[model samples]
Target: MRLAFIGLFFLCTTIYAKQPAVTPHGVETPGVQTLPYVIDGNVKVFHLIAEPVEKVIYNGKINLLEEFVKKNNRYSGPTMKLPVEIQKIDGWGYNGNIPGPTIIVNQGDFVRFHVSNHLPEPTTVHWHGMIVPNDQDGTGGTADPVIMPGKTAVYEFQIVNEPGTYMYHSGFNDTKQALKGLDGFLLVLPKDGVDLASSDFAIMLQDWAIPEGSEQIKYLSMDRNWFTYNGLAAPNFPVLVVDEGERVRIRFGNLGLMSHPIHLHGYSFKITGTEGGPIQESAQWPAATVVIAPGETRDIEFIANNPGLWRLHCHVLHHILNDTSYFAQHQKNGIFPEGGLWTYLYVKPAKDQMTRASE
Candidate 1:
């Protein structure tokens, strides 16, 4: 009887010892299951081998010109000018345009951004999607220091992530600064140069509002009554010129408060890539309208097989108007042709393109 009791006690104690300990949040088991949240010691570890920054060419260099400008005398707009040239837009933008300069770089290339702030307040540039080193990140207090008024700062990082569409914007006082139109894009082209075409383009959709004829944007108002593509509303929106039968790539990005379902008339395009990187060919699908949400970028490609002046605009009815400029009666039947974020794609005939090519 004494031996039987001793054996039974030992068996119960052994069984209890094998049971896992339950904590409020996790379970602590034995061996590989010691900690539910902890990484297994026996798991294989892999390191990402990147090119040395010093040995690679820092080919893409940009100078950010962040400032407040008075356009049309009464309208106030924020702008960013890169190198004071390359491209310039009147709408609130970096380097003097809305949707700032598209920083294009080959995969594995190094990039250097020299930011100069001419705004009334301090600011910093945050690489929106790329994995930059903590110190190079422009998060102001937590990462790099801010660029004070009339001061400059530099941010350097390598393109180690997969080739895709990313973005950059004011990180300091983001609520006010970014809302005031201080943002742009970063395009990483694959080194192999797959799907390279002459018709590649980039467009950024943004919203704005000023009191009727006021030249300055309503910085405090959430109701952005004005809409634009690269800073100009429709009737003034730039036309995308392409040739018939040519493969065209349009890179679309949105930094506004609303998502835009951009409808491309007469063509079903494939979303080839996004901020996350190029989607595999087998996984790509076709759509007539691609939706771009806030802080997101998408790349779509299609062959311009049909030749004509095709309308490209946001499908949302309200996105087709600028403030109270349009009357309910005027748009009761269809969208007013002279307002909103609409643009045209002038797909010329093959013969026309050839004739113009020689000139």
Candidate 2:
């Protein structure tokens, strides 16, 4: 009986080891959605609608003002009153999501986009960091005509560039449209079909200027008070979960006004690629923080060896804090406090480690 049991154990182990690892196809954008596409013979077709969207930046039950006062004992003034409900702000987005949904495709594939405009003004989607025919570049008045309100425009192109991180945003009134959250990521993978990492994540960074008492975002204002990742502020951003010792990749895209120095705690990672494409392995260097400037994209990779919940946030003091202007007002009343572009990386134990521990 003992001999038979030993043989069965070895057979089971062999079968398990032979099973192919399920590879992830596309990158995940936590707190945001991905746009779906349909394959038609030789082309991938995607539809997008430009319209107004109400995004919830802060949905926690805790009142930020009260929490700020508690953390700072110097505040003796009356408590700053705020609504006791979720904070929803209005902005323009693609397909009903702030920052829009990510579009993923393999290199060498033909792509077509059907973009419909529902906004008050005309707009065009310029493919940033992508090399395509000038006529299909989606630059209003130069390469292509803008899509008027209630009208749809078609953009067809081939993925001629190498695998890399790219972006799409409004070409007409670029600054104003992007500031109002009309942008998204476009990830082009290699045709060879090799998975880059075990866990891949995409983060879209944006800054907003919303008046103290209003939910409408000020697209023309130079001052920004709220910073977000995937359209969510700090403490509200979705946590990124991975297994210990797994390879991880994070892609960041910035369409906001200011540059964001994204910092990751507990590990030093290598900057692997950018909007232009992957950097040679020999040229890649280790860094704990990478600065993503306006209209830029960056990709980083690391091994999640340390098993714990680590912080990944922007190093900009005000960018990590919510409603900087509101905090400033409380400071005038002797209450100074902190907290936007932030999330946690939860690395759990590997399956083998967990099994050994249980035994």
Candidate 3:
């Protein structure tokens, strides 16, 4: 316990007053902030200071994977390296955290965030799902890297747009970081507001790799070859619970660039929304799982039907492993032809495990 407290204290002290520029004579940078939830309340803000990152990928020289290798270096890409923070043994995983944090927001509101660069280079944020300006679009040049180290840039925009499941990530090197863990889920509630009592819930599915005994956190390595749902692999699956007889909505958002045919072992939900945002009518589809593509969003709703412990995961079993090779090496391995788990739906419904409590 003492060690945990000490670690937390050190992290707070460093980040609280962390000046840009990662190293001496480096680019002095500011801090990054973010807005947790965009409710109807007064303006609220949050922050995230991104520093330059470098990572290493150890590719396996076995099987078909070797065919994808480039000149002794199995891994070949524009940038396989990324800045990574080691785990502090308290909530902090190698790459900072798991499932990251739940991003909250509501319909008809405004959100302003100042993304500061602590790294020696440059970076920016892109509001993945929500509609914003070409500038607040949060990308490189399209918006702008909030200045380099030592400086700060703020992204201001009205959340005056569609809501549902959305995403936000480093638009600077989106093709890379965004695919990694640099992204989080965003929820835009309705005008009347969101109802936690019986209405909304969210789940973000991602697969990451943190090489054992290394300060570097590689989002995904084709070689490490481990997969997880919301960062959890099978057997380590999370149990989602709710009132047995109540109506419930499961908001599944796919932040990974790969498509996930998420199957619910038991309950079937209504495909109520898509990446384009919420569907107008209750145009419903009854299925155990739904196909969700990256940079895309989907919302599913269903009454607490045959409730029991259910498994909600990407139909891509390999992804159920690590998302590494599923995306990094073989694009074909990433594709789902003729509506497989990557296209169609799968369900394994059972009875509720919780006893009916007498009121």
User: Please, what are the lDDT tens digits per residue for candidate 2 over residues 1-359?
Assistant: 99999999999999977865434645798867788999899999999999998888877554323322224444557644432245678889999998899998889999999999999999999999999999888889887898999999999999998888899998898877878889999998888767758789999998999987688898888778888888887666767878888889999999989999999999999999998988999999999999999988999999999876577889987787777787676655533223378777777667544431221
Candidate 2 positional error at 234, Å = 1.7
For residues 90-189, write the lDDT of model 1, one tens digit per residue: 2334654444555665587666666777677778888888888998778997867878877877777778878777777778888767766777667676
Please report the TM-score between candidate 3 and the true structure: 0.62
Best by lDDT: 2
Query: TM-score of the candidate numbered 1?
Result: 0.69
Candidate 2: Cα lDDT at 300: 97
Estimate, for each residue in 229-277, the C-alpha lDDT of model 3 and write its tens digit.
4443433332444555555666666665566788876665678877578
TM-score of each: 0.69, 0.86, 0.62
Off by over 4 Å in 1: 1-92, 192-194, 325-335, 354-359
